[model samples]
Every structure is written in structure tokens, then in C-alpha cells.
Target: MKSILRLAAATVCAFTLLALQAVTAQQVQIEGSVNLTPFEARGITLSTLYKVDGEFAGKQGIAVPAPFTLAAPRRDGQQILAQAKPAGGGPIKIYFATDDPQKRIFSSLQIIPFTMKTDDPQKRLEIGDYFAIDLLKKLGENRTTRVNLRRQVTVGGLPAAEVVGNFVNAEGDQLLVRLVAVAKPGSPHGIIGIAVGHPRQGRIKKVEDIYDTSASLAFDTVTFN
Candidate 1:
């Protein structure tokens, strides 16, 4: 009965592997006082409108429009609006909060249309560097600092970067910020995704889970319309 025993062992191994995969693939959830509505991922087509003189009249200039998907969470008491461009599409503000800065939730994806001059090989940009520049502008030189950074590829095999860190808000509270960026060669715009959450030690897991879910949903579910 040696052959029968071998078959039984193989079956047991197969089942064990599947059980491990299921555990690791479990869905992540947010845990904290502030609850956020689930994020919905969707795709939209983009196109440019032109005047009779061929003048640039589209929200995204004269570039040919394409389709891209973005994920965003529903805002409390606010209606979601979509804006389209030749290279990007998403809500005006992915997340917003009032009265308390620490309680704010955010997730967003955007594509930056790069001009011919900026797209040159010599001038090509690393996604994370672009994010740091933008953050400096918004948070000022003294308030923004790079905490943890990693260079990784997106699910679509596109070049990408991710950074998780903290910045001081105007109210003097430390807030955590997470950013992910993806770039495709010769594209009109590079994709930039961002998420922000609470900074308390007990809430760090929830904040990170939110960011992970937002990024996973956007990258894994996005499709060309």
C-alpha cells in the first residue's frame, strides 16, 4: 500500500497550501473611532473637445483621450463628482474632513500630463521625487519630512514608488501620509495615488490598512474603458 500512502500525503500537502493562501489573502479592515465608507473602484473614458480653429479647448488639452480607472471613498454628506482629462480621471478631492484635522481620511489617484519637453529621457522623473516636491509646496519646508520610502513596481508592472511618513498640520498635530506613484513611459501623465490617516500608535494599523486597501483596489481593479 506504499502507492496509496503517497497519494494521501500529496493531497494533504495541497490542502495545507490552500489554507495558508486563504489566510494571507483575507480582506483588510479599518479599526478605529472614525469609520469610512467603502471605496468604489470605477473606470472612465477621456476625450478632448476642440474649437473650430483647432485651439486647445479640452480640460486635458489636445492630447488624445484614453480610459483609466480610479478608486475613491464616499464622502459623508457630500455627492461625488468626476473630472476627466486626456491622461487622468478622478474626484476633485479624494477625501476631506472638517473641524478636526487628525480625523481626516483621504485616498486619490491622478495622472500628471507631461509635455514633450518634460518627457525627455534626460528629464524623466522618479515618482517619489515628484511627490516630495509637491509635499514641500503644500506643507512648507519645515513641516514635511520623508519617513519610510520604497521603490516598487505596480501590479501592472509599471515603475512605482511608495512613501509612508508624517507631517505636521497647521493645528500642530502630527498626521500620517502615504503616497504611491506609478509611471508609464511616454504617457501623457503619470499616475499618483495617495492616502492619509491618524497618527496615534493604536490607530496606525487602521491607517495603514486604509492605505493598503485604497491602493490595492485602484491598481488591481483599474481597467481601460
Candidate 2:
């Protein structure tokens, strides 16, 4: 009888833990096209290109996404043409709304989403971990270095307080580092992969060589600490 009571207690504990997690979990929604490149979480993100521009198509409630293009026609003064539909694989739902980029929704219109792998605010990128890019300075020869980076910013898009760091270009050249900004927490490919070339020095002689150039590197994939 004692053993049976212990087993029952364990079962209750398991169910309680699961219920708590379900309530505390934070959901993250990824946006953009299925092939938005680098955005592995991409599915069928019906960009606001159509609705945002004040366009509408189809009759009443219908979501049209074919050829997976960002073409939205306008009708009357409607925004979203119709209710969104699934592209193919099931994970997210897309819809039309004018002011949603700054808002969060949790119904069917979650066009693209990924459950937040982790939410520890402190588990983020350190300062000066990324590279600065001033395409204007390197436009002529398309070559820049760790010494040329302009500024640093947090991956959250907030400006960083300092402009100090370095990275090597693909051509074995040291690059002054200025992180464009820290990458967001749930970024699948937010790490800035850089490759610099001079006229025809062979775009990045080798992948490993790029890492060899003087610089720093930090990363936070799905498994955020």
C-alpha cells in the first residue's frame, strides 16, 4: 500500500508540472515568406505588402496565397483581402492587418511562429560581439576590415553604447568591429556571416580563413541560455 501511494503521488506531481509549464511558456511568432532565406522558421508569411498598401482581392472572407508572391490588390478601403489560409505545412497562420507589426496576436493568423526556446533576458549577446557595416566606405573595392566598423548595437535593434571590436574579412584582412546591433533572441541565422573581397581575390579564399582573421565571435542559437 505504501508503494502504491508513492506512485500516485508521482503521477500527480508530473501532471502539475506540465500544467504549470503550459501556463508559463512564452510563444514567439516568426514572420516572412517560407523561403525568406536564412530564416529557417519561414513558412508562408503573407507580407503586409498587399494589405498595408491599401489593397484587397477576392469576395468576402477568403485568403489567397499562390505562387507565394507579395501581391495584394486593393478594393474599396479594405485592408486584409480575406481570411488567411495554410500554405502547406502546418505551424503558422497568416492574415491581413494594417497595424500588427507592433502588436502580438494569438489566434489563427499567426502566419509564422516559433515557441520561444528560452526567455531568460540575461541570456543574450554581449557588447562588441558582432561587426559594423558601412557599405558606403567599401563600395568602390567592396573591401572593409575590423578597423572600419562604425558602431555597435544590441541584437534587439537597440543602439549599443560603444563602437569597439574587430573581425577579419574573407581576404585575411583584419576588420575593425562595430556591431551593427545585437541579434534578437530567437534568431535562427542572426549571426552576421561576413565575406569581403577585393576585385577578384576569390570571395573568401576559404571559410575557415575568415574566422582566422583577427576578431571576436559570439553566438546564441535556438537554445538560448
lDDT of each: 0.36, 0.25
Runs of candidate 1 exceeding 4 Å displacement = 1-67, 73-91, 96-128, 131-137, 140-144, 200-210, 213-225
Please report, as a residue range, the 10-residue window in candidate 2 with the lowest summed lDDT. Answer: 16-25
lDDT of 2 by residue, 1-225 (tens): 334334323311221100001111123222332222222233322323313111222422332221122322221222332223233221223322223333211101211111112233332232213112322223123433234334333432432323333334334444232222233344421223122222122322433333222111111111112
Per-candidate TM-score against the hidden true structure: 0.46, 0.20
- Displacement of the residue 209 alpha carbon in candidate 1, Å: 4.2
Model 1: per-residue lDDT, tens digit, 1-225?
A: 334324322311221100001011122111112223234322222211112111222433534232344434333432222233311222122222221423233332333322122444333344334543344234323535446545454535555565656566555545555555544466634434444454432334543554543323444333322
For lDDT, the strongest prediction is 1
lDDT of 2: 0.25
